[model samples]
Target: MKNVSLGLALFTLVACSPVSQKNKGKKYFADLLKDVDKIQLKFFNHGDTLAESITDQTEIDIYKELITGKRDPKQKIKCDSTGEILFLSKKDVILHAWFSSRATGSKYDKACVTYSVEPESYGSALTVRSGQDIDDYYYKLRSTANRMAQH
Candidate 1:
C-alpha cells in the first residue's frame, strides 16, 4: 500500500505539468545559470570580455530582435558577427562568436551554439541555453521563437 501511495503521488505531480512531459524527449540546459550570482549581458568576443557589456537598451532590443528573428532560409548563413554582432553567452560572458565547427554534410547548414537563433532549435539557442529557463527566461525567448519556423 505504501508503494501504491508513492506511485500515485508521483503520477499526480507529473500529470499536473504537461509542459514537463512535453520536454521529456527534449533537452534543456539544466545548470548553465545555476551558480551565476551576477546576471550580465555582455559581448562574447567583440574586443574585450569585460569591456563590452550590454548596458544600452537599444543594444538589448537589437539582441532581442535577433533572437526572435528568423534567419533567411536562402541566406546560406555564416555567423561572422561583423565584430559587433553575433554575441551569445558561454560562461556568464556572452560571446559574439562560437566554437569551431565542421560541416556535417547534412541538409542543415553549419551551425554553432550561438549561431542558431531559430525557435525550432531551442536546445542550443544562446539566449535559451544561457538563460536556461532561469526565472521564466524561456518564456520571453519562446514567445519570440514561436513566431519563427523550424530549420
Candidate 2:
C-alpha cells in the first residue's frame, strides 16, 4: 500500500507539471505588454547603447505588433544575437527581447525573450523566425542606430 501510494503521487506530479509547448500556430511570446508605455531598442554591436526609445503610442503599437509576430514552423539552429529591445511600463521592464539572425544577410531571425511580468506560458525560452520581415526589421534597426549616432 505504501509503494502504491508513492507511485500514484509521482504520477500525479508528472501529470500536473506544465509543459512548454512549441510555438506552432501560436504567438511567439505572450502578450505581456498591455501596460507597456515605451519600447527601447538597444543594439549589441552598435556600442550596446539605447538606439531608440519609442514612447509614441503609434510607434509602440507598431513595434509590439512586429515583436509579437508569428513563429516559424521549423526550429532553425542559429543564434547570432544582434541586439535586444526592452518593453517598459514607466521605469520597469515588462518584457526583454534578444533578437538574433542565422547569419549576416540571411532571412532567418530568432527572438529569445524573458518576461519580467508573467503570463500563462511564462519562463519558457522561445525562438521565432519570420524570414524577410525580420531581416528587414533588423536592417531598419541597424540603419536607424547608425543614422542616429551620426547626429
Candidate 3:
C-alpha cells in the first residue's frame, strides 16, 4: 500500500510538472512579442530603414494603407502623438510601436501596429512542436513590425 501510494504521488508530480496548455499559449505570445521588441530595438539602435527590410510589395502596400487610413476596414489601429501606432492582428496578436503609448521606458514595448497573416486558406489549426511554432510566430511578428515601422 505504501509503495502504491508513493508511486501515485510521483506520477502526479510528473504529470503536473509539464507546462499547461494555456500557459503554453501565453508563452507563445510572450515570445513573439519579445522577438518583435528585439527587432525594433535593433532598428532604432542602428537607425536603419525598416521598409528596406521588407521584400513583399503587397505587405508594404497594406502597411501604407494602414497608416494612411485608406484601407484597414477594422480600423483597430491608432497613432498617438509620438507617431506610434497600435495594431491588433486577427489571431489575437497584439503589437505596439517602439515609442507607442503603452511603452514605459522599457525595451520590450508593444508594437505600433499589429496584424495577422493567415495562411492563404481557412482551415483547422494544426498542432506542432513548440520550437516550430515559435519560429513561425517570430517571422509573422517581424513582418508585422516591419510593415508598421515603414509606414
Q: Write the per-residue lDDT of candidate 2 for residues 1-151, one digit (tens) a residue.
A: 9999999999987876544333321243335567889987665654554355778887676556544434333644354456566889987987776655543232445444323223332222232333333445556777787798799
What are the runs in model 3 whose C-alpha is more than 4 Å off? Answer: 25-40, 44-151
C-alpha local distance difference test of each model: 0.35, 0.54, 0.34
Model 2 stretches with alpha carbons more than 4 Å out: 1-14, 20-31, 46-50, 66-77, 101-151
- Per-model TM values vs. the true structure: 0.27, 0.50, 0.22
* C-alpha RMSD between model 3 and the true structure: 17.2
C-alpha RMSD for every candidate? 14.8, 6.7, 17.2
lDDT of 1 at 106: 19
Better of 2 and 3 by lDDT: 2
**Against the true structure, whose lDDT is highest?**
2
Cα error, residue 17 of model 1, in Å, equals 14
**Ten residues in a row with the worst lDDT in model 2?**
116-125
Which portions of model 1 miss their true places by more than 4 Å? 1-50, 80-114, 117-151
Model 3 residue 83 CA deviation (Å) reads 18
Give the alpha carbon lDDT tens digit for every residue of 1-151 in model 1. Answer: 9999999999999888775534432123223222323224322222333223444444444344333323345644554221223343444443233321222111333432333322233223234323232213323434445455363
Best by TM-score: 2
